[model samples]
Target: MAASTQRRGRRIMMAPEELDTFLREARTCRVATVSADGTPHVGALWFVWDGTSLWLYSITRSKRWAQLRRDPRISVVVDDGEDYGELRGVELSGTVEFVGEAPRTGEPCPELDVPERLFPAKNFGLDDMPHDGRHAWMRLTPTAIASWDFRKLGGL
Candidate 1:
């Protein structure tokens, strides 16, 4: 006898609400970008999902920034799974647009502080943290998205 596949498809598919909830609670995403020469770079990033787009805060002098400036196309993966049945993830492919200049040498931008506000709260359950460096913020507007939940594969 064959196990049912109804739950399989449903589980793998995240409804709009489920997807938003998962993204809201996720801590990290693997951000992928390409260099001018076509080499690929992937880095784990702390992000904030504001319903419509993902906001990323990064050091202006980092390699990821350099590569992104050269080519803005990017892909991001947010997933977790210690076991097969628990696996769930989302992939967002898009282009990044710089939202604003890096903050002054030792100050924070009140408007672009989502990462500063969210990182601590989500990762450590804290509401605030000292601002770090001259950081720039970028917004990723996803062109396509794909997601899955292995729990759907249950009922076997």
Candidate 2:
């Protein structure tokens, strides 16, 4: 995971610990990918943050999957708060690496164990991951990150 290069709004920037907690508590992230035609596609996904990386479980047959196969570059944003003073968010950008089988059939991969355990427990309240054979994992060890919490501005 590369360090965040955020210079602007330093007062509002989230600390490393705060960023970790925010990502862990946030449920959805908007993923951005480049299409083969040079356009951009954005979609919402439920993701797990492992402190060092972000793991995305996506449908192998979806357009997002197809686009990623063609171009692995991606950017993801997880944000919260409706009010201006309460707003906070994190943005992670990097190329993603496909992990395990394309359509995961629960094949044993040690690299996936942590995320597999964390994802279900966080999202579904389950002890173990339920593999459907249609969804697979993509790991993004971000090259760049930017985060902010407006509350840190002291109500400014």
lDDT of each: 0.77, 0.94
Give candidate 1's error at residue 135 in angstroms.
2.2
For candidate 1, the 10 contiguous residues with the lowest summed lDDT are 1-10
**Candidate 1's residue-wise lDDT over 88-116, tens digit each?**
89888878988655642435466556655
Query: All predictions: root-mean-square deviation over Cα?
Result: 6.4, 0.9
> In model 1, where do residues sit more than 4 Å from their true spots?
1-11, 103-120, 124-129
C-alpha positional error of residue 36 in candidate 1 after TM-score superposition, expressed in Å: 1.3
Worst 10 residues of 2 by lDDT: 1-10
Instruction: Estimate TM-scores for all models.
Output: 0.80, 0.97
The parts of candidate 2 lying over 4 Å away from their true place are: none
Mind sharing the TM-score for model 1? 0.80
Candidate 1: residue pairs that collide: none
Alpha carbon lDDT at 19, candidate 2 = 96
lDDT of each residue in 43-88, candidate 2, tens digit only: 9999999999999999999999999999999999999998899999
